[model samples]
Target: MLDFFTIFSKGGIVLWYFQGTSQIFTQSVNSLIKSVILQERTGSNQFTHEALTLKYKLDNEFELIYVVAYQKILQLSYVDKFLDAIQLEFRNKYKDDLQNSALSSNFDFRQDFDRILFEVEHAAKKQIQKGKVMKSFEESEKSKKSVKSMIENKKEEPPKKSGKGKENKPVKKTPVKEQEVKKTSSVPMATSNTSNGELDEETIRKNRERLFGPAKKKKSAADVSKSPKSPDNNKKRVKVGTKWVLGGTSEDAKELDYTDGTADNLDVNGVGVSLKDEELDYVGRMKGELRDVETESESEEEEEEETVTQKTSSKKSSGGMFSMFKNLVGSKMLTEEDVAPVLDKFREHLVSKNVAADIALKLCESVSAKLEGKVLGTFSSINSTVKTALTESLVQILSPRRRVDILRDAMDSKQKKQPYCITFCGVNGVGKSTNLAKICFWLIENGFRVLIAACDTFRAGAVEQLRTHTRKLNALHPAERHGGQQMVQLYEKGYGKDAAGIAMEAINFARDCHIDIVLVDTAGRMQDNEPLMRALAKLIKVNQPDLVLFVGEALVGNEAVDQLTKFNQALADHSNMTNPRLIDGIILTKFDTIDDKVGAAISMTYTTGQPIVFVGTGQTYTDLRNLNAKAVVHALLK
Candidate 1:
């Protein structure tokens, strides 16, 4: 049973309160609950306060807090059902009052609160009864199974033997046991013919017949243990189709004619003592004739070489081997076809890193054009050359024209006595509010007075979410409380209000209060949403925020480019400016979620020509870090 239930607007304003029987709410207890509600927007739904357990349920416009005090633990499902029912009823009954801030001022919902509680109690009781019936049915089914097993055990028992001297009669076994015995034994079991189950001669004879065949003789253990003898040497070996030749045979040696020794002494360089004078004269005469013939041949060869060279020169001019080879391979100039393989592979590498296909192709093409015809060093291969080129190109693209000097801007705003207004824009679930709070924390740490504006009226709990951040920030760095001025303020007007007007008002308030920086968190809107985009443009135009940083997820790859482009175009058109109202920079959130596919950071910067100012590394406010180009490029390449 609920101890008490309270309904409050998202802004922490109590709308109605109901006290259960024997339940009392002191001032301190009420303050504690309100403090918890203000601090936590989306956390564990239950917390302990004193002796009671406070369970909370949140909706678009209001939050329902139920105080549950019980001796035994209760099911959360029941509590949830009750809370859901009451929340629906209250919202329906007070829709007008909830939407209109004017009516909510004097609205008293205690009258309808009792009726809503009664309906919820009745419905909860019915569900509890249904649960009990299901549990009882399950218990009864278990009991039936236990009783049936006992009866089966009794039926399977056999009667004991009457006398020890009398021949024991075999009892009939159950079919289940019989099947088990049959599966284990290869031979069939013999049954007794007598009704008393006495084994007779015929049963014994049949059992013996089943154990051993009638004609065949069984071998002894000695015969089974002896090994078989080897085959006789004279036995013919099996003749496979292909003959196996082990060593050289005499027939192969005889085919080589080893007996021939006549040519051994016929050496051309050996001296021979013969009738040499006439032979020497003949040799000398032959030598003189050979020399005359050689002279004529040399003259003819020289004339033929000169004629061939002249004919070749007349046909085509002779060029150096290196120049001719270059012309053949076209090494002086490089074409797309020349480096197509390298570019294709590099493009694939970029795509695998989550870079978009077209963007990857463009990067590859740019690299290829720069690398064409360039002589590669001895240590550098095509892959290394391409990687170096890509890294340089990426660094150039990621290097923004102007760096975001947040601290300097804040200081300037402080000097001018006007708050440096920054509006955060992004798609849904890109951590706009969270990053806004992170920036606020950064400003506060830098000794600048920061104020948060919750102008995100579109999303449920958007304002509450920002408020939660501000509460944490204030708790971490408490205000001085001098002259009743807060160091950090969260300005929210609840849901269903003009977000642009709310932002403008917040800015005006910030300016008057001499705040250093005002971080305006806008509702996460898609780039294609025309009306929302126009509204955002109006918000920016009316306030002319000093910095409009686009928050995007690093895991979105090249899609972040398209989103920022469309957003910039929309803002430019709505502002009616010649040049588009460009985003000052990007704040990439969830950077840690994308491990290796960090190419989105490169792609976003490359496509938008904007630098990433800061990155949200984790859930904490301190996780925000400045973006380093070299580290990012190294991470991508590595």
Candidate 2:
């Protein structure tokens, strides 16, 4: 039996021979299982799991041939629609076994499908409830119709039940007649109340009419009716010709259609009044429309206020001005010189004006930092090199005609021209950085790509200070710190002493990048420092920059000329100097600080061959004036 059950699990051809009670039978059941699982059936797998079995008994001289046939069976959830008698044939034949298998089956059909079944059942119940309610409504309507028909029949055959219901009918008729009389009497009261409530101004006229009966020649319809009792009253009623008016009258002006007007007396007793339907409709529609508009407008205003509040909160919590100030101070390109004293003054002024210390500090720092980094930076002068260049070597290039032609050429060459690389050489506090920035601005304005190299890396704020000018001029600064592995390492590498070599490396970098102009701001040293001068001269030789600008403070006095001569001489005689070219131009800064004009004139005298290209009048970037011999003469002559 178990061997036959294995075949029933899935159908296959079974060759079986039972030897005895514990004998085993072997058959090729693989083909049967594969065939049954793949076969197409009428009701699909939902009806029943039916596996066909083919059995044969092998018999030669040693074996007898016998055959047994059965169906493999299993329990499964079936579609109710497919649970027909024909589909249940296998279950009927093996009813006891199949029922036991179904009871023991591990499949949890209800657990998985209960929700969907419940939803479908709920929807069906709701639809049935709706149908029942509709049917009830129809029955009630039918009952109402039946009651109406019975009432009509009673009216037609009043004699049939008249005697039996006579007393009850009289009671109903008496109340009905009294109700009609009461209703008639209350109409006048309602009209009077309406008149009083609506038209207080018309009270006097109304009171006079009410106090007296109808005039003999103008008796009302009510008066005429009462006159039927007396012929004299009838005569009076005929003379009065009774009349009644149903509408109100007012003495005060009333607003109608947004205009002030005396209301027309609506003579209900007569037929002269008229009304327009469109006007009433328009007024009603407009009232509702205006209410809706008002509601929407109020909602919009609330939303706007909330949005503004959110924006204000965001600005407040964002650390606004303070964060901005910090960023400005922390930038890679600003120094003490870049940030001026005016910033502190402004902060103090804000505090004096009753602004909070923290707030004022934040605002002032932000404004000053932006000014230093952008507005101030662009116009701020670390040095005034533009005036120096323009007043000297570039003067011949400044003719209006020449400038105009160059302007045109510059516009065209702007796409092709290589930027110039130059260096400013001078002692400390000579306004080298300030002048270099001013020249950078001039070049940028003239459509030149200018870059500044802060080779004077020894000063604490030297790099930052140089960056301040580049920031002000709004020029591109490609190199930040070039200490190691740089083509030009401005600082010393290890134990090496290669200042000239470092400068050459920087020059090579500029060459490789094809930078338009390289302005190397050399470290401030004494004009008589021969070793430094030699190093600088060697750098100049290697870089071969277009021009060398000499920056000196106007406060240097007569010693300024000597300083100039010394540096110029060194530049001219550095090494096997064939062409004795010394300093190309002179930049005199801080003239505004100098009280003596003679000092400036004497300094100019030292640069006999070299022209004074620029003069610093004040501390501002724009304060440096283009040095004209005539302007110097005026300031000195004055």
Candidate 3:
């Protein structure tokens, strides 16, 4: 039995829904929309959330999605057929409403739904019964006559003659030897007769000459390989030598210049400050390109304009189902052959943009599966339709499951007198600390006090780096402005301390100090480092930050998937929880460096099913930006 059925528009408008149970399915439906539909993962037909399993069908032309949810334990066999039948019936009944997306909430299809469901279930049951039913007596018979009549009519073939081997055995021929070869094989053998069937004197001489290489063409490899060079073949051996003697050069100090008073260069009286070991090992702040700062008004205007263009494009693309492919001359169904070429080219485009090869292949397969056997409109082309679908899919991939409002969340945490903790972790040199500072700066810019925990105790100058960033951020918003409370502060216990304990202590310190957010900077380690991974897992499990952001580089291609996958696996394994906590989100650093090769974004998102929480586009504190799914996809395809 179905627990829920719903039809919704791509723009988040629910047209009609049927609920068969009192249990609220809002969370399940929302999750389906967020984790599956919005993620452009329609490539998969089924989604499992807790106890329910959801199956969905997408109507690209109508920009609609039909979903059905049921208990996972039930082995419902008719969901697919039922979905297809309902889709047809609904489309036929409300073709105009769907085409226009009007009366979306005004449709009444309870009767149609119930009738279709019942018919589907009945057909399924009948199919099962038919398979189990036994055949009648006459139906199982090869002959329709009575047993006595069949016995009388039955006949056997007469035995064949036993003298076959004695008289009719095939006569084996002694092969005709060269006589047949001369007649069949066109390639003249070296010792075979000429066209006259005889080896003449002139032919023999010519054959002998041809057997070896021509004199002018140089000796044959066989001759050279078998014959060694003799002394007479070489000119007089001339030994040419210039600066070297047969014997080694004499060991002498004649050219030595150590006689000069080297003590004249040394001055013991000159005094200077002695640098400490820490000073000698200090690393200066990193530098890179920064994103151009955008004014609040300008950003809002751009967002509004982008939204308008997107809406217009979507409306134009699928306003009327038939209008889509109207330019294709006539309506025709798509086959594997029709879309294969386009999907191949699309896959190459994704790969060139640094998408993983396997991921690209699968994406092409998904597109092919969706387009196969589907009718194209008279107005469209295969390339264009495939591109449109691919674009939509990519946009869904980049779209986050939820609107991540860090500022709002931090504000809430501040109200509750608890620090909002965001921990940054990733492979080494991925700009984790830098991006942490960028986020910290953003938090401070919004008037919230931030504490950066230097939990990267393994690496030298890790604490100092955060300290420098804290100072810079505080300078940008000095303490004189917020009642003498510094906007940004760094909490550190120096190097060689337990990172996990440091993080826990930092959180409590922030809570006590009234800090709005604590950005914990964990040491970067390769995904394969078990000890470090265990340490990282312990930090997350112990402190349990509100958000665990994995920092990854955008420049990576196929390695992106492996790195993120391993990191997540390590966390889950090391955390040792029944439902272990994996990477909650991603911080994609060096976004600007990747150009159009934005496939790492897709790889990371696909691997973890998490969002790109922040993209570090530049070096400055203000260079961070939220991912724009459409813009990213556009760049990717381009």
Say which candidate scores most in TM-score: 3
Model 2 alpha-carbon miss at residue 242, Å: 99
Worst 10 residues of 1 by lDDT: 286-295
Q: Any runs in candidate 3 off by more than 4 Å, and if so which?
A: 1-26, 61-64, 89-337, 361-379, 415-417, 441-449, 464-488, 528-531, 566-582, 618-630
Whole-model Cα lDDT of every candidate shown, in order: 0.68, 0.45, 0.78
Instruction: Write candidate 2's Cα lDDT for 62-145 as tens digits.
Output: 111223323445221221211232113333444464335442333323332334334444665676677776456555766667
- TM-score per prediction, in order, is 0.47, 0.32, 0.60
lDDT string, candidate 3, 278-300, tens digits: 43332122222223212236587
Q: Cα-based RMSD of the predictions, in order?
A: 36.6, 44.8, 14.0
Worst 10 residues of 3 by lDDT: 281-290
The residue-level lDDT of candidate 1 at 201 comes to 73
> Clashing pairs in model 3?
325-377, 325-378, 325-379, 325-380, 326-378, 326-379, 327-378, 327-379, 328-378
How do the candidates rank by TM-score, highest first?
3, 1, 2
Off by over 4 Å in 2: 1-418, 471-499, 595-598
Pairwise TM-score winner, candidates 1 and 3: 3
Candidate 1, 99-130: lDDT as tens digits? 56643565566666666667777877888788
Worst lDDT run of 10 residues, candidate 2, spans 286-295
